[model samples]
Target: MTTARLDPDIVARLVGDAVTAPSMHNAQPWKFVFRRADDVMEVHGDAERAMTRADPHHRALHLGCAAALFNLRVSAARHGLRARVHLLPDDSQPWLLATAAIGGVPGEDQELAALHTALRRRHTSRFPFSDEPVPDALLDGLRSAARWEGCRLTVAGDWHLDTLLGLVRDAEHREDIDPLVRAETAAWVSPAHATSGERRDGMPAEVFGPRSSAGSSAVRDFGRDRSMADRGWAVFEERPQLALLGTPTDTRADWLRAGQALERVLLQATADGLATSMTSQPLEWPELRWTARDPLDAMGHVQMVLRLGYGPQGPGTPRRPVADVLEIRD
Candidate 1:
């Protein structure tokens, strides 16, 4: 079968759409290469950007990269092309997480292309949220989004909320003591530099929501270590509406699926006019990770803690230009 060559300009445009995906601390730890000869675009996890101290197993790294892969698929479909993906195609080259061959007409899967608009709009909102409850129907749709990707999304109830909030606090305390974890987070966040002068990757200080004087344990304080004095303070919701994105198994493939589901739910939420933030702190800890799973529900493994509500959307984080991330080869 002849593999039709894709134009380099089209590949770059699709990748620009892909790198908009969210990553932990906005690390943007992924790279893509398009093989014109094979019509395959390979996605790789960049070990240089890996959070060695916090995510030693590369779970978070995988999620972030897979999220980009999901975006690539979405972008392709929206452009009237289809993306056929293969996860971890070469075990010998472990960093080669996935490869997507782009060609053919878009699939009949309407939902896949539906998220195109949300791709550009979804941002991680770290600011305080109003106490308004999300509608059950919207929540259900988010849940179904995860289900479609072979994962589960469980909204925390009153009882579960308290437990999850405490776990976040515990995770924060761990970060405080672990210098390496603190360093990893500090390196990524820059509040002083404007977006124009900023690096291509990492969380800009503007997106780091104001430190809470109210002492909310659920929200993370990115300014704690960096001490951005200019960053103001705000009151996060007393009871934040949170959800757990989980998968039944913990493997490279499951992480990939969770990442896709995560972006899907986030984009859907964005389209619905909701702001979102996420914390994987508890999941970063081996001792606390298992307990993050809902007792009543068999979630298996919780991949991320999502905060959802009405609030100011976070400032858009920086992404490496398509030229930097995607390479073309014969």
Candidate 2:
């Protein structure tokens, strides 16, 4: 870190790491602009890449982009720099979600830098997790991770978890019947590596994991319509470990906060040797979203539901090349 402007190469590297952050359907709806003059990097929500049907309010869009912002901060700290973030800095420019001014000395934030290792190692594990439970200590640490970003992480109890699973089923039924929602999801999913050319984004067929053989799947089945004869099937954990991330208020700023927290929790879980996957099916529907929350808990608006346990870390999903997602300006 120094008073001098950061190098463009370093900025590019930072953005490269940032873009690895997850998005719903792996849409990767984020863009980065590195202003070499000011040593600042800007993160923008890519409306074109947004899941318009599932996320009409762009709540998930903000979450995905903010996850990238969190990654940028982690990258900078790893490289002996500081990323000073300004959330929703420009009201007139709504899509301009955040800007990270880069500068500082070595060891700016050891905690943030520590998460750098998990950046690339962490992938959404759509595969089945063992029935082995996640220890309470690890879960507590994850809660702290979310709290550090001003959000709440509540691990659902048995009854609450069952209720969430029911909501997910309900949401899935609604998605099956709705033409627009189904089309939107299908558009972002690439079958067998890619139905098209070299795809830089979207959940590939290989990562969809084996279809749940049991009565109901705790995870979202992306390939429900596709034949599972080839993909095979497995019985998921009888009681899948679940957690909910939430904010006290539902606003753009709150969504931004929740996104960073979501990534933080995920990275921490990855570093802790836990496989993770995100489920927002219930949160995507307005009517069912509120029910996803625990009435006994104080969490306001639930942002994401996560499954965590020991299992195969799912293969990497495609991310847009840095050159495609990042721009450098003189």
lDDT of 1 at 16: 91
TM values, all candidates: 0.97, 0.97
Worst 10 residues of 1 by lDDT: 189-198
Tens digits of per-residue lDDT, candidate 2, 152-271, equal 999999899989999988998999999999999999877766545598888778888988888567788888877746788888988889999999999999999999999999999999
Clashing residue pairs, backbone N/CA/C < 3 A, model 2: 1-104
lDDT of 1 by residue, 244-326 (tens): 99998899999998998999899999988999999778889999998888889988889999999998877887777777777
The parts of candidate 2 lying over 4 Å away from their true place are: 1-4, 106-108, 194-197
Cα error of candidate 1 at position 308, Å: 0.9
Candidate-wise lDDT, in order: 0.87, 0.90
**Roughly what TM-score does model 1 have, to 2 decimal places?**
0.97
How well does candidate 1 match the true structure, expressed as C-alpha RMSD?
Answer: 1.3
Residue 20, candidate 1: alpha-carbon lDDT? 93
